[model samples]
Target: MITNDVLRRVRYALQLNDKKMLEIFASVDNAIDENYLHSIMEKEGEENFVFCRDSLLSLFLDGLINEKRGKKEGSSPVILPAKAILSNNDILRKLRIALNFKEDDMLNALASAEFPVSKSELSALFRKRDHRNYKECGDQLLRNFLNGITERFRGTSGKDA
Candidate 1:
């Protein structure tokens, strides 16, 4: 899953405005202006569209966690290790943490998008990479999850449209 897509989906799912999006980024010490944010959100082929790097996406995910779950009382926010590549599993984990979602919530959300998933299958997606049971999440799963989130937050009738 592309970071830009993830960011855009999250923004739409949460109905966050430009100011709120900036605040979320700032919460994790990643200062980004509205113009930059908009550029990043733009369609890939659009003029001025900026490709969002993994570090920025990681920062945004961290910021999202802080925004939703509240920052730890005394400790500094944990910085994601700088990595050149980010996997779909990383994105799924960050989203789960940020939303405080339980296994049941994830199952329900996936099901809401008509993407049936068994408990064991869902658990496999969250397992450590070295674990034998770990399964790589595909783009389709993330896409469904995002669509499910949109339905959950915005309602099935497309009232938010």
Candidate 2:
């Protein structure tokens, strides 16, 4: 479940307009219209807000907001999830859509990161399931990919990792 505050923060962080957000939600099957979505965003009454079920709102908030609780706040700084970092499924889907990179890009990212798996194997894995099912090699592969991406960011300081 996504709290209203979290949603507002994510909306600001992503710099997304209601229309863009509605499109993203609609693409994910949450069929909300733009006007109502906008109204929801503008409404200050948190209790009155209606968040959708399995609507990707949680995922969006998770991937976009970095929770920062200060020392004076009486709690440790919690790393809020970003809408980009929502779930493995969300992550994979976002990556696929954002990069629009062909198979070579995935392979290059892996290889550049020193991952041992070939592009073919990775492609096969992607084909096998909408989300990767890691029994043995899966976790390692994911970790390696993550490491590679981190390394790439370290080098480029680019957005959209």
Candidate 3:
């Protein structure tokens, strides 16, 4: 999924206002004003739409974790791999951390959206690439996960999910 879409969906799922969104960004020391935030939130192909880079998304995810779970004392923020391309796996991992979800909660969230996921299958999604058990997360899985998030937090899934 596009970073903008992820940001928009997450914002809706969490019922965040612009001010809160700004604060979330600020939590990670990335100060974005309302105009920049709006541009990033704009639809693809729209004039003034700013493509969200992987680093920015990474910062936002870190900020989200801090916003929801509180910042850890004496811990430094995680830095994204330099020049790394963000993937669905990265997004999923970040969301999991931000929500502080355990294995069962993730499974339940997916089930809540009628996208039942087996425990082992879900585990594979979080595995390290060279672990032999690792499986790359597909766009469909991320979409379903986000839909499940919507159901879990917003009381409803997307109409077409």
Indicate which candidate wins on lDDT.
3
Predictions: Cα RMSD each: 2.2, 14.6, 1.7
lDDT tens digits by residue: candidate 3, 1-161: 88898888888888889999999888887889999999998989999999988888888898999988899998766667788888889899999999999999999888887889899999999998899999999877888888888888888874432
Q: What's each prediction's TM-score? A: 0.92, 0.38, 0.93
| Superior by TM-score: candidate 1 or candidate 3 | 3
Clashes found in each candidate (C-alpha, N, C closer than 3 A) = 0, 11, 0
Total backbone collisions, model 2: 11
Best by TM-score: 3
lDDT of 2 by residue, 25-48 (tens): 554334577666755564355654
Candidate 1 lDDT tens digits, 11-103: 888889999999988987788998999999987799989999888888888888888988877755556566667788888899999889999
Question: Candidate 3 overall Cα lDDT vs. reference?
Answer: 0.87
How does candidate 2 fare on TM-score? 0.38
- Tell how far residue 111 is off in model 3, in angstroms: 1.6
Lowest lDDT sum, 10 consecutive residues, model 2, at 62-71
Q: Which ten residues in a row have the lowest lDDT in candidate 3?
A: 152-161
- Report clash pairs, candidate 3: none
